[model samples]
Target chain A: MLDRIRIVLIGTSHPGNIGAAARAMKTMGLSQLAVVAPRCDPRDGEAFARSSGAEDILEAMQQFETLEAAVTDCTLVVGASARSRTLPWPLCSPRELSASLPGELSGSDTGLALVFGREDVGLSNSELQRCHRHVHIPTSEHYSSLNLAAAVQVLAYECRQAWLTTTPVTSPEPFGVEWDNPLASHADTERLFEHLERTLINIGFHDPDNPRQLMARLRRLLLRSRMDSMELNILRGILTRIERHGDPNGNDHPR
Target chain B: MLDRIRIVLIGTSHPGNIGAAARAMKTMGLSQLAVVAPRCDPRDGEAFARSSGAEDILEAMQQFETLEAAVTDCTLVVGASARSRTLPWPLCSPRELSASLPGELSGSDTGLALVFGREDVGLSNSELQRCHRHVHIPTSEHYSSLNLAAAVQVLAYECRQAWLTTTPVTSPEPFGVEWDNPLASHADTERLFEHLERTLINIGFHDPDNPRQLMARLRRLLLRSRMDSMELNILRGILTRIERHGDPNGNDHPR
Candidate 1:
């Protein structure tokens, strides 16, 4: 899913940010890079210097004269902007953007583009309007601006998380006995509770009309225990025997 | 919960970083600041100049003779370091560190302390040992080093998020059903579950020999729904009547 997504740098001024962006994309298992009119040479000494070992992405980078040319093949375009734009076109949080990408690009041959603007000016209104969605990087209210590379890193991290979560992962097996299939049945357990309630009523342990806290506490205790079928049956048996012995009249206990 | 977070800087050399740390903390709604063995006076012009209106944090900062003195009152001590240590003592991711704070400090007067080291060299081995846990922020492998102020900002942001999550705020009253006062008690629900299991057995819905997935699914469903006392009673009442009618023979029903 990540491979199908192409990250486009639109009018990027800093060679270091372009390099860093490549590194970020590579870390998150994304490689397709399209540079739209980069001011600095992406393959220059400074660009590769900042790119670290992600020079491969810079080497394979495709240059485009215009943003439209860069994103023409793309089906879903995500524009990265620190500040909100005047025109709205499906504004999404980073989390939502990450989540929506996989489904939108699954099995589709069409490319998905993530466009990042220059550090100083950012994406113009016309530039932002070309994209399907706008993603904002949450920052401190005092200083909402983020370093260009840092923004790329945050977005890349989120994308990786989305990919990992969607993929299957093994988990440890659960402990404890199977509850659904024990010696006792649902019928037996219900009878046991009825008998217990009756016994409580008989012993003046409960006042049904204006019951206080005892029952609630008792319920919490039982829930915490996570009783299995066999165990419940055993308890029920005891209750039934006790009820039979205590009630000779066989009259149903009143609430 | 935000008030309970104590930010401690040990042997800090840069006065600017100290001021910046104060600003970061204030931005995240964290007020407590402690300085231990600072190379420069925290109240110096350089420190105050960079504080950026967070002078109150510097003014209220406590000076400690030793790291031990600073963390003496704290129950949960988190040490921040960029590099891994020789002997790892329960290393925690930033998110884990954030999540663990609330539970560790709940109802306790003891504050949660986050210890940061100098800008040049992080916490010493002995100083790191004083912390109950160590947390490392995820950074690029090429340049994992983060500016001291930047590190503080990231940590403070995470801490603020954790604190807000733990601290319950007033919410709008739930609409529709009185979930808090469900007709059934917890005890009643447990009984219903038991009875339902028995019914399932009789109906061949549950196989005794091999039953794990189904039971787990059922339990998960009930747990997610958050069954209440009143709801439990209503269900139990229905189950009791069904058991009595379905299996009239007392001997056949057993317990």
Candidate 2:
């Protein structure tokens, strides 16, 4: 699992940050680093000084011309971003992201790319949209500025923890604790959400005419819980049961 | 709750670390700083340079000869340490520490003091014992060395999160410089310092070329101490009286 994780830094402004980031990644046993259009030389003196003996990682760094180029080969691409956009994307806490990783990396040669943005503005719109998910590091609301390397260190630390432990059948069980089954995948979860939303509208529970933020909020809630295959099946069965009574043409005679 | 969080630096060898720590604390709305037997002058140019805009915190800093004295009034003293001693004290990860804070600071006249030790070796065994709890920020196991300022920033960030969510019951007025008055703004504080430096110089108490960093250090100390408007007026009044006594023509009373 460790070998499958890639750290991608995009449009990094400082050479020192690249060096520090390399050091941060290496400390957690992560060696794969891809730099996309960095503003400074990765092997500069400041970078070496900040690496504090982890210069080997910097020496082996791979350079890319664009964010798309960096994560093109990875199956799972995650953006480390704190910003929210007009259209909501799937978001994961570091723990949740960690818990999901072992399951994703279990059988495939496919890799996971953890992408960080420039020190200032973070990932561009298209870059963030390219990610499979976004991870937010909880910090103070007023003083939310975390150093770039520190952010990498935190996410890498979480990945290391998850790599050392078994993936819970449901998301976020106690560390080192295992379950009998694996959680449903993102694709499966989205299908379940669509099924649930359609059933809710059929039953007159959710009004499409004045649809506020119901489905989006449900997506947020269920995605955080991370249901297993059994949980998903049970939920879908209930939705199917309710579907028989609430179809547009099912009412024989209106009372 | 912000007022109740006190930051203590014990035997800190560099003045720059103190300034950086002050800046970190102020960004998260914490103001109290206590320095215990620091080896370097707290008023040095390095401190001012690193403090950024948080010199108010440095100005208000309290000096102590011993760790015990520094935390005498604190109901809960927590030490930020990376190394463990022969016997383990009650230890908390940073997340656990954040979860426990809201319960501790609410409805209490007492305060909590977070103590950080020397840059190289962490707190002495006795000093660690002085704390009610020990918090360790989870970092890379291989290269777990975090800068002093960064550690402080991480902890302060957590405290700020806790503060924003909790209900306000009481203000931490007793610990501040003056009761029943809010702290003077940075602009007001700067004016007060100007008033002070001019008076001290006019009284011939401060030499021009050999002035050393007395004024600069004093700015750091008083700013961090967070004196209120009333306290500012009282301090200026004292300086006014001292100037009258030190005037060159005041000693000609036929003696």
Candidate 1 displacement at residue B112 in angstroms: 4.4
lDDT of 2 by residue, A1-255 (tens): 788899999988888888878877876778899999998887789988878778778888899998767766665778898776664556666767887777666634447889999888998866775565688876545554566776787777778767767544344342234533454554555568779778666544567888675565455334434455566665565455445323323342112
What's the DockQ for every one of the candidates? 0.05, 0.03
User: Can you give the lDDT of residue B219 in candidate 1?
Assistant: 39
* Residue-level lDDT tens digits of model 1 in B1-255: 778888999888878778878877876778899999998887788888777778889999999989877876565667897777544344666666766656545533446789999877889976765554567765545445455666677677678656656655233111122234532222343456677667555434567687654444443334323344554564454345444433435332333
Q: Scored by CA lDDT, what does every candidate get?
A: 0.66, 0.72
Q: Largest TM-score belongs to which candidate?
A: 2
**What is the lDDT, from 0 to 100, of the residue A6 in candidate 1?**
84
The lDDT, on a scale of 0 to 1, for candidate 2 is 0.72
**How much native contact recovery, as a fraction, does model 1 achieve?**
0.01
Off by over 4 Å in 1: A1-6, A20-34, A41-49, A52-57, A101-105, A108-112, A167-255, B1-74, B80-88, B98-128, B136-157, B160-255
Give per-residue CA lDDT, model 1, range A67-160, as digits (tens): 9998887888889977776666788866678787677767657667888898788888888888888987655565544556556665765675
Cα miss at A102, model 1 (Å)?
4.6
Encode model 2's per-residue lDDT on B1-255: one tens digit a residue: 889999999888888878878877876788899999998998688997778667888999999999989988888899998987789899987667877888887756778899998888878998999888999866666667666776787678678757755755344342311234555888888888888778655534446678776576456446544565666665565455444433334442111
